[model samples]
Target: MDIADLTPAERRVWEAFPLGEGVDFREGADDDPAAGASWGPERTVRAEVLRALLLGGPVRDDGIAGLKLWGARITGRLDLKYGTVEHSIRLRSCHFEGAPDLYGARIVALVLNDSVLPGLTAGNLRSEGVVRITCCRIRGPVRLAGAKISSGFFANGARLGSPDETPEEPVLQLNHAEVSTDVWAVGLTVHGQVRMNGATVGGQVNIENAVLSAPGGTALHAETLVVGTDLNARGIHARGRVNLSGARIPRHLSLTRSRLSNPDELALRISSCVIGELWLQEAARIEGTVNFRRAQVDLLHVPPEVWPEHVRIDGLSYRVLAPHRSAEQRLPLLERETEGYLPYSYEQLTAAYRTLGDDAAARTVQLAKLRRHRRTLPRYARLWGYVQDAAVGYGFRPMRAGGWLLLLLCTGTLAFALHHPPALKPSEAPGFNPLFYTLDLLLPIIDFGQESAFAPHGWYQWLSYLLIATGWVLATTIAAGITRSLNRQ
Candidate 1:
């Protein structure tokens, strides 16, 4: 069938994700003459599926784009290698017989927005078809990288782990896409974006490395869609936790309302790639930032609800205790990690402490952070005072805080005494002394008794009790905080 007449917007947008092609060989008699010459491309079920897809026969573009595939059985490999299939090419509700390869094919517009790719194997798959299975499920990982499409790629909330030993990475790939405008793929189903090498997008994109990006709007999207800039999404929805520990996104990189649960050694890495800006803090919920180099990470318009919980880092004991690096002073390597928590935002204090070149400072910061979390993890505590030199380090000091508490106590006590002198008569009481002289200099503030101290009165009886209450509160809080500090040491 002929391609549907394209609209101006569709044509322009399609140009960004130019499709590539490659040769694929099905093990037919032609592909391998050793098979008794009986197996041919025509008889193979794989050949039939390919014919249905490319020839616009059974798997027509219109129906596939809208994801209207109900039930159909094809028992072979569907090879759309190097072929450009516009609209949709659905296999929903249908069963496959063997591992398929819709690889190296450029599939624009998807309709699997409510479909599934169940119970089969498509080892190396690449089809950036949009509107994919937001409601469907996948039992295997389908690689859709090396293939570029315009918009509507989903697979959010889809399960992505294989029950077998040879589980594939992320099933989809958007590594290098010729993106001219925005694309929407938030909350769709995906075992994962298996290959995200060099895929670029001009507009905004949605989809968490682990979950969704927004509660209402799509997970990812560009503020202003670019026409020629190819959005390289290689390693975008990578397996495991996303490692952007020290990554520097130049543009608005959002990861809102998403869940990143990968626990691999190097969860995700976005090191040294000069991006526009990372609008994360709020949208990009990560385990934590991994160690990498970065600059100009934008932090605007992030959805506050999806902020990442800082992970307690274990590597580079110095970085943890010393202090954090600034977005400007931090390394340029793209990285992420779920190692540990950072009490303070590293970017906030990087400039002030950069010149110190003190590794212990990093350790100090880390220990102080552990205290805030109250984490008794022996490792977190051990590094605090020993490897980090907790005593000599500049951390939260309870003693210093206690100083303020003492001042407050003293002021309140003095005020109460002045407000009311003792009830004893001066002639019958002890002789005048330094205590009385002290009252003369300070008895007017807070309406303290203006005419007492030496004469002795009864205001002391009532005000004294009030001041005592204030003193107890201040003293108790300070004492508790100080105790915790001492215990840490």
Candidate 2:
């Protein structure tokens, strides 16, 4: 295409392409390449020129004078709805007075690097290649709902802010969008919500070092999102909730050193998510509750004490909890989070300890769970449970029963020796030996003719019956504990 063949508007753009080639455009200098470039006297591109460019037709000479519209101001709406654009559009450091309407358009590739745009309305856009918007400043909301990008979406170092600075409004909405590769938004800053709920990513969604602030609402709402690899948001500082509930990540969900603050509600709600590994460690400060109810993960690498005191981990399943720590250290952390007798929590902790081959720790958790459950029983049943716990630790500690038996024997022997009892039948010589008699009364199944031949009177009779009942109860408890221990082994 020769310069003589270009239209008046295209000719202006062609002339301004090489005017300031080597000048830095970031300083907002007046002599910049795009400073003199405009749509035309009418401040609008003709439909014919846009159609020709979108159709991949020749626009400039094939040499060092090739067309490169840098810092040009597209004054009017560039509506390409439902159109098929075959060529790669590279517009750098340009400005758009109005948002481009690309709804349902099929483009090859789009590179708007370092451009200042009002916003983008690209719903259902099908890009065969990458969509690059690196270092751009978007002053309004970018609606990319249901977009399908073959490569990825790169918006690194970009600043996305709402037009009215509304905290509830979404600055970058990617709901249900599907990307073949990663969604790279590293070091990005968003003044409103970055809503990516139900989006699907073939690779990782890297939002490392991003600053997201949407106070009193969700800053990052990616609920039900499906990521093929990791979803890393490390070093993020979010003022509102980071909700990732029901998300499915095959690899890991890393939020290391991130600070999330939503004091009244949940700061991180990861309920029902299926992740390979979850890392909320290394100085991650969350001001609100981090709920993990019903979530399943292979490993959870969080320092339990560092987390907020209001974590909700009921029904959360993980194969390993703090695998880097020993069982003795982890057990206390697990116990500290449990609220009363949460059976599922105890079961999960017990399974984790068992997986580490720490059977003693596992049993200890089970015993604590049982004791807590006993506290919730009815009056009579609770009394019985207390007796079982005190005697044998509910069949988990047999030595406790042995100690009870020793105490009973000492008490019964002292009582019997202090007061001698009369014989049932009068003997020729008075017999008042008490050691063998105490044993006879204490052992329920043994009788040395003291209980049958002679009987105690008044208080002594009541004491003897008490000794008999104590003997039977202690013997039965010891037998039960021994049986349970052997069976468990």
Candidate 3:
């Protein structure tokens, strides 16, 4: 593979393409700095010649092996429409005169580190290796719709912006793209929306420390994305909504210390997602509602005190609420939700506590939920709810029945002592005490012969019957509550 063996067209393009002072492409080239350098120095290359070499070039191994164009400005639009580039295009600190159109092109790999581009239109691109564009600055939008990258898409520290700054237009669009590895955009900044809707990533999507601003619109629209690993966006500052609805991430979706501010609408919509772990702790400030409706996760870790007040947790099921915190501490956090009582919310929480093997805590949540349900009932039913609550707390607090019984006994004894009712039958005892008479009237099943002997007149007779009925209701409630508790045990 000598330069003399190149075709006339290829030989002319290769001669015009500038290689630095220390690069050589003779036959049997080795990794010796004295023989030649792996990367070239700063120089400009005609876009057509560079394209010719990339499309059909004869090198030592028929690949761009020792070609590293540093500070090289490529002139004209490097269009590779439907062409297959077989070499790794590694350009560092290069400047493009126009946007390189790789539309419908298949390439081995692409690395444009520390470069400046007007814009990129690489729609329907197919790459076998990484697409590394680290620390680059693009003045216009980057369109990669329907692209397929076998390895990662690394764009760390890149700054992207659109010409119109429109909220509807995305600065970096990767819609329906498939990446075999991660999409690393750590510390990246974008002026408009970064849309990755319907994309599939085999590894994590790390956007940590990124600044994304699309005010009054979606900053990061990743709806229906399927990430095999975690989607770590910790320390992100987003001015608009960060939507991940219908996404499925098997590992975790963390937003720790992220600041999302879309005060008018939903700042984050994670509804209908299936995630393994969801982390929104460490003072993650979300100004608007974070809807988690119908989302299922194995664990949800959030600081209770710092949780956003505007959250919709309906049908959001989690096996554990805060595994790192105590049950008593986590219960108040769920109770502080501003989204009012949804019965399923409490039910999910009860199931989570039950999974933790804390049935008492689960029952407490169920009791609280029952009280919430009672509040929504009709007035007649509400009165019955009050009776049930006072007696046994919907069978969760059986000790309350003993407190009611003591209160009844004290009141009955005081009433009988104040006004003594005459006995219908003659008493053989010399001193007739009212305490025994009141006990007989209060207890429904037990009789000491005093209730039959004592006859109250007018209102007193009515009061005695009322007391007996009240005692019977309370006794039945207490017995039922005790039976339920025993059965649960």
Candidate 4:
């Protein structure tokens, strides 16, 4: 690394490496990488020279030590695979001809903010400090699989994907990576899928206001992810499925005001996840099915109208639901399960209503459950179910049974009052009263003396038989309804 052998651009970097000084080659604020096309070789630095200097290649002893260059044109690949850098590296507003490869490298800190790069490969990389790539416009995939970051990974406002937007692989992937702190990717715009499967984040993963578009494929795939805190993706606009299946977030997962539209497919798949609180309020519009199958959430803040047309809640368990609504308003949510007639879902809805101390709503949900269950029964059994429903509202509405009984009594009284029955035996006959006679016939196991004293004749006998049969049927239905209700409890 002799000064005489160094080129003009290399000489500046060599001179500044000892003291960790920054060199800005741009003439103005708008002098981006595209504007560097007109710049001469004086602003170009070979990647090997920087690599040599970073690996302790004959530098004068100075107090500070880091690489901070801006607006420079990097000529070759900055390959630092399996190497250890003792100092920070900041390459802001720079243009790289090749993607930087830092696979299996251990670096103190790294910053490539506001740079236009082809791509980056930092798989298995271990960084002790923050790795910031904010506002960068990368035209290729950025892989950080198996990486371990101590501070955090910030990629705010970064645009990742190819120019043609037909990436065969994920645009940004950090599978199995461990971040001790937050992963701040707010306002990120990714054209392809962003995968973070099996990753563990000790802090929040804030991707609010981000735009993710992968029409036919998944937009965000974070399966088996474990977030120690909230995953705030509020106001995000995703055109494909945002799958968080098997994730465990111990805090809130806010999707408030987000717009997800993957028609005829899954819009948001959080199946098998264990989340603390899930916020889908503020008119979050989800077009496709939201599968919450087997997910256990502590608190849910989804409005009734925010439910998508299709949902899969086969094993969804939640402790609390916001905006406590009546069964009439919330029962439709359980009805929206694509796989119809899951008794567990109905029971879950009933339990949720009961948790809110709305016993009336809970009973209504149970009644609806019986009605739904009846649809799957045999025709004859369904007819019996209809009888029970009409008689006692399946034991949910006991007052209806009383109303029916009163109506039958009135009908019997009117018919018998107009035409009284003759006494069977004149010597032992009591006084004739049509009301008492009707009561005697209607009461199944009761006698009022008038029924036995005055025996009905002609059509009057047939009317008495009808009344007696009606009374027995009512008694049987009421008893069956009571038993069914007790069993449910």
Candidate 5:
């Protein structure tokens, strides 16, 4: 790695490494590949030459030794696997002949901004400072699996994946990576999956305005991802499912204005996830089913209409629902739960309305729950349910009982007044009032003296028997409904 043996581009990079100054070689080079067919050896530098300088080569110790080359055509693989570099490396607008293999390497910082590469193999990489791959074009997967970065990882506006159809392979993989700070991938475009399963981020994971398309497979699979603060994916358009199952985001999980299009399959899966605030705003559109099974959210900011036709919310719990609506409006959401007859879903909806201090709406939800439960009952049980519903509205409507009682009283009073019953014994009987006589027949538990003294015959006797039967049925149904309401409270 002698300075005399270095090429012209390598010599410039070597001379500029001591003071951490950058060398620019893009003065007359064409940006388009077809037009730049004659990039000669003067603009080319061997990867080993750069690697030798980084590994304490014959450079003067001015205390600012680093590599900051710009627009150089790097030849051969920049293989630094299992190696250590104390200085930061910044290669901007460079074209790598092969992917730089930094597997199990330790470096201070690595910035490959605006670079074009075949792929990257930096799995198990330990970087003390930031790893910035901003605005780059990568033809294959960028693997950072099991990487531990102390600072942050930024890949804003990067286009990743091969032109050949391989949707099953991940374009960007950060599985099990641990980042101390944020992961900013704003406006990123990925042709295959962006898999970050089991990755842990200390700060936010912002992928706003990102476009991911893997039509038959998952677009983004961040299952079991742990984010300390927020996961902001606002305005992201994903063609396949975005699965965040078992993810834990303590602060916010925002998907505002995002479009998830996996029409036949699940568009989004937050199953078993625990989020602080889940924001699925009005503008967000999901073409397929969304599963929130076993997920817990502190605050859910989703409109009723924002939900797709199919949503599985079994065991899903949320403390508060934003922009609250009446129970009538929100009750339909519970019905969208794919699992039929899940009482927990209905109860959760009722509690949400109660938290808003809408007691009437809460009662309405309870009544609806009873009706839904009725559909699963046998024919005989359903008949009893119909009686209870008509008599007392399952205790949700208390006034209905009173109305029925008044109607029965009026029918009996008029019938008895028109045809008075004969007394059992004239000497023992007192002159009977029509209202008291009717009350005696209608009230099975209460005994007015006139009921024992008088004796009805023919049609009058049949009317009395009907009234007694009606009284027992009404009393039983009313008592049952009241007991159910109390139990619910």
Candidate 6:
């Protein structure tokens, strides 16, 4: 209303305001040419100008649809703590130079684009409506403890540095808000977002947990803005380096946690706000020096949100080894969540295990899952064949032991021929060398596993040879029977 209605401290601020020569009277809908002409022809609001605006009574309805305080010198404490504005607001070019409290200030549409405000002490403020505060400065710790807004609100490219006199709380606190639409602060240099959380927003939020020092970043308790939907940011610069250490993404996208020292350099943490769908696809390269440690995605079995490919890539890319077999049997694609969710099943685990030469374990994994999810498993479960063959073969390194058996047989036969007596000599036979008959007769004994009976050794060695031959015959018969059964199927 009028300076007469204000408190004593507010009245003193009003009385001193007009006397400050450099009053940069700016209009909400127009740039202040008077603001340009006031500073001794140099076009600037000196400290005196800021002091004047600080003392001016609650900005009255000066006939304009909106008003701009420009660069007003807030020399004294200005309290508009319970004031209310009905129209839109703009603070595009202004600075704060006092302990101004707007604790309950409410406006319809407010914008604080490209502004800077520093105070003598505390920074307790509030705003409502479509607020925009891009490229501004707040040198003192700010507290907008509980505020409400109706539309989109933005404060990008803002900085938060401790003023000449510092406030004990965080540099910026937005504890809660109630916004009807989007709330964004893309490249804000906040001491943190403790102040921002005060408002309960109903739309998407874009505060990237912006800083790295004593506040900000996804560190312990002091995180940036807790967003409503699609929380996103990219090219975010942090102070002592950034950390997304334990921040959980409720939707989809998340940068592999990393250090971001600068927005203009490699240290910037890039974000792709769309965390839904849980999958980013194959050609997606994060294009930074970020290292993804252990992160996973949430996936559903149906309406498949990018499966097989995404799952395998994430699993193989990040070297997701087999987790507990129980987990593997449950959801095969767990390894792929980092990149996206995939329907990893026991079949995939089988493929992985086969590569590791763990056929038995792989078979076991498949068998366990097969009981419940046989339909989901691959058709040709190789484990069936492996169980029939591998277990029986035990330590069967065929080449060495199989070759030794053939050599022993041939050498034994030659010895037997040499040891034969004169009647057994083929040269004395009439018209028959008997070489063919000797082989024909000897082949049966070998088949019967009786080759050791003719062995240069004794009965025990003969029994061993017979046993070896019998095992072979039994194994061959079993293999043939299996082949026949499979063929029938």
Question: Which run of 10 residues does model 6 get worst, by summed lDDT?
Answer: 266-275
Q: Each model's TM-score? A: 0.42, 0.79, 0.83, 0.92, 0.90, 0.47
> Candidate 2's residue-wise lDDT over 304-330, tens digit each?
555775777888999987745554455
By TM-score: ranked, best first: 4, 5, 3, 2, 6, 1
Q: Give the Cα-based TM-score of candidate 6 against the true structure.
A: 0.47
CA lDDT, every model vs. true structure:
0.39, 0.76, 0.78, 0.88, 0.87, 0.42
Candidate maximizing TM-score: 4
Output the TM-score of candidate 4. Answer: 0.92
| lDDT score, candidate 2, position 222 | 94
Q: Whole-model lDDT for model 1 versus the true structure?
A: 0.39
Question: RMSD in angstroms, all models?
Answer: 15.8, 5.2, 6.1, 2.9, 3.1, 12.7
Residue 69 lDDT in candidate 3: 57
Tell how far residue 460 is off in model 3, in angstroms.
3.0
Task: Give the runs in model 2 whose Cα sits over 4 Å from its true position.
Answer: 1-52, 59-69, 162-164, 323-341, 420-468, 471-489
Tens-place lDDT digits, model 5, residues 84-166: 99889999888888899999999999999888888999999999999999989888889999999999999999999854768
Q: lDDT of model 3 at residue 240?
A: 90
Ranking by lDDT: 4, 5, 3, 2, 6, 1
- Candidate 4, 21-101: lDDT as tens digits: 888887788887855546678889988888887877544565578898999989889999999998789999998888999
Q: Write the per-residue lDDT of candidate 1 for residues 1-489, one digit (tens) a residue.
A: 222443332222223222311122233322321231243333222334344534453332233222223233344555665566654454443334444555555555444332234432322334454545554455565555444554545555554434342443444444444443444444444433344445455555544344422221122222222322223332233335443333223454543333443432433344443345343332244443333333223232233233233323232211121223333233211112243344334433332243355433434444444443455456666565452233322233434434544554466446544454543455554444433333333332322332243433365444444444544544454566567556646
The candidate with the higher lDDT, 1 or 4, is 4
Worst 10 residues of 2 by lDDT: 18-27
- Predicted model with the maximum lDDT: 4
